[model samples]
Target: MKRFVVRLLINSVALWLTTLIVAGVSVESYDADDTLATVLTYLLVGLIFGVVNAVIGNFIRIVAFPIYLLTLGLIALVVNALLLLLVAWISELIGFGLSVDGFWWGVLGAIVLGLLSWLIGVLLRPIMGRSR
Candidate 1:
C-alpha cells in the first residue's frame, strides 16, 4: 500500500542520515559509485530493520513487559539497540548491508534512527494525511 511504501522510504532516509551522523554505524553498497545500488542497499536495510522490529521487537517487548515496568521503560533502549544489532547481523549474512561497530554504536545508532524517523513522520504528517 501507499502507507507502507511511504514508511519504507522514511525509514530508509532516516537510516541514511543516521549513518552519516554516527561514525560507528554504516551501510555498505554493492558498488560505492553506483547511486542506485547504494540507495537500494539503504532501502533493503530499512526493510529488514522494519520487519525485524515488527516481529522480534514486538515479541521481546511483550515478554519483557514486567522488566520494562520495573525499569520504567529504560530497558527499551537496550532492546532497541539489540534489535538494531540483529538487523546488522541479518544484513551481514547477505554480505552487504548495515554494519554496526558494537553494542554502544548500535544504541547510539538506534537513538539517532528513531529520532530521525519521528521527525520525518511529523514533518510529513500533513502531506500524508492524519492517521486514524
Candidate 2:
C-alpha cells in the first residue's frame, strides 16, 4: 500500500508535468483555480494511471512480444505511447480535462512525459527508494 501510494505520487507528478509540456491536452486535471482540488485530482488520476499501467501494461508487453522482437524493441516505445493515449481516453470518459491530440502527438507526448517521470523518479530514488 505504501509503495502504491508512492507510485501514484510519482505518476501524478508525471501527469502534472504532461500538462506543462503538451498542448491541446485534456487530462483528468482540475482547474488551477482550486489548488486543493487540483492536487486531489492529480492524486486520483495518478492512482488510476498506476493501476491501469500495472494491469494492462504487463499484458500488452506480453502479447506484443512478437512486435517487440520484430522491431528490435522499438515497439516498446509505441506501446508506452499507446498506454498514455489509453490513459487519456479513460480520463476523457471520466471527465478529466486531458486529451491527446493524435497518434504522433501521443507518441511524442508520452515519450517526453515518460522521460520526465523517469528522471524525477530517479532523482527521488535517494530519498524514496533505490529499486522497485
Candidate 3:
C-alpha cells in the first residue's frame, strides 16, 4: 500500500514535469481556480496511466515479443507512446485530464515521463529500501 502510493506520487510528479517540458502534452485541471482540484487531476491521470501500463502495456509486450526481438527493442518506444495515447484517450472520456497533441507528441511525452520516473525511483531507492 505504501509502496503503491509512493509510486503513484512519483508518477504524478513525473507527469507534471513532463507537461512542463513537453509543449504538446498537458493535463487539464478540473477546476482552474482550485489548486487541490488540479493536484487531484494529476493524481487521477497518473493512476490511469499506471493501470493502463500494467494491464495493456504488459499484454502488448507479450504479444509483440517477436517484433521486439526483430526490432532490437526499438519498438518499445512506439509501444510506450501508444500506451500514453491510450491513457490520454481514456482521460479525455473522463472530461479533464491528459491531452496529447499527436503521436509524435505522445512519443516525446512518454520518453520524458519514463526518464523522469526512472530518475525519481533511483533517487528514492534508499528511502524505499529497494535495490536495482
- Give one digit per residue, the lDDT tens place, for model 2 in 11-60: 88888887788784445446767888788887877776777788999999
For residue 115, model 1's alpha carbon misses the true position, in angstroms, by: 0.5
Q: Name the lDDT of candidate 3.
A: 0.95
Better of 2 and 3 by TM-score: 3
RMSD of 2: 1.9
* Model 1: per-residue Cα lDDT over 16-74, one tens digit each: 99999999999999899999999999999999999999899999999999999999999
In order, the Cα lDDT scores of the candidates are: 0.95, 0.77, 0.95
In model 1, the Cα lDDT at residue 108 comes to: 97
- List clashing residue pairs in candidate 2: 26-97, 26-98, 26-99, 27-97, 27-98, 28-96
Question: All predictions: root-mean-square deviation over Cα?
Answer: 0.9, 1.9, 1.1
- In angstroms, the error of model 3 at 18 is 0.1
